[model samples]
Target: MRLRYLLLTLGIVVLGLLSRKTSICSIDFVRMYVGDVLWAMMVYFGCRLLFVSLKKSASFGVALSFSYLIEVSQLYHAPWIDSIRATTLGGLVLGFGFLWSDIACYTVGVTLGFWVDSLPGWGRK
Candidate 1:
């Protein structure tokens, strides 16, 4: 179960990165928005990977709360935080600006994550 989540997270992160580099006319919207969605799911799965004992609801709650907190943090622009957001790595981890759309993306991502997690796993050993 843990391995499955880890692999899914890795795959999503790769696709998200690729989405930024590749310009597909049909998926332009996905390229723009999917990253946010994948990021939210990555956070959820990463949390689950660490706290393997966490119940599904608790994991979802933590993921949603953490993602929301990151989104909310964008509203602040202190010099220190701003400096961090300026760097590439920092910018990726902590986004530069706030968008209401991002909240919706997070919701969608977390909901999908929950559904995936609930699936019966043939991969489980």
Candidate 2:
């Protein structure tokens, strides 16, 4: 269980990084959406691993809420926050702007996480 979620989280993070670094095959749409979606997925996986007793629905809800909090945080732009956003890691995590589209992406990602967790043997102890 732990190994499965760990690999999934690593894979999603790698894909998210590739989405930002590579512009392959008209995948710019993916470049736009993948980050936020996989961010939620990664969070879901991490949450599941950490809180092993939690239900999938609960984990998904927590991940979605965290994603929304980060998205909403974009509305604030203090100099310190802006400085943090200027860094690649911070920018990727905190984001620079808010978009309604990102909310949809997060929902989709968390839903995917929920579905994936529902698979046989996935959430089993």
Most accurate candidate by lDDT: 2
Rate residue 59 of model 2 by lDDT. 89
What's each prediction's TM-score?
Answer: 0.89, 0.91
Q: Tens digit of lDDT per residue, candidate 1, span 33-62? A: 988998988888887888888888898999
Report how far off residue 104 is in candidate 1 (Å). Answer: 0.2
Shift of residue 49 alpha carbon in model 1, Å: 0.3
RMSD of each: 2.3, 1.5
Please provide the root mean square deviation of candidate 2 (C-alpha atoms, Å): 1.5
Clashing pairs in 1: none
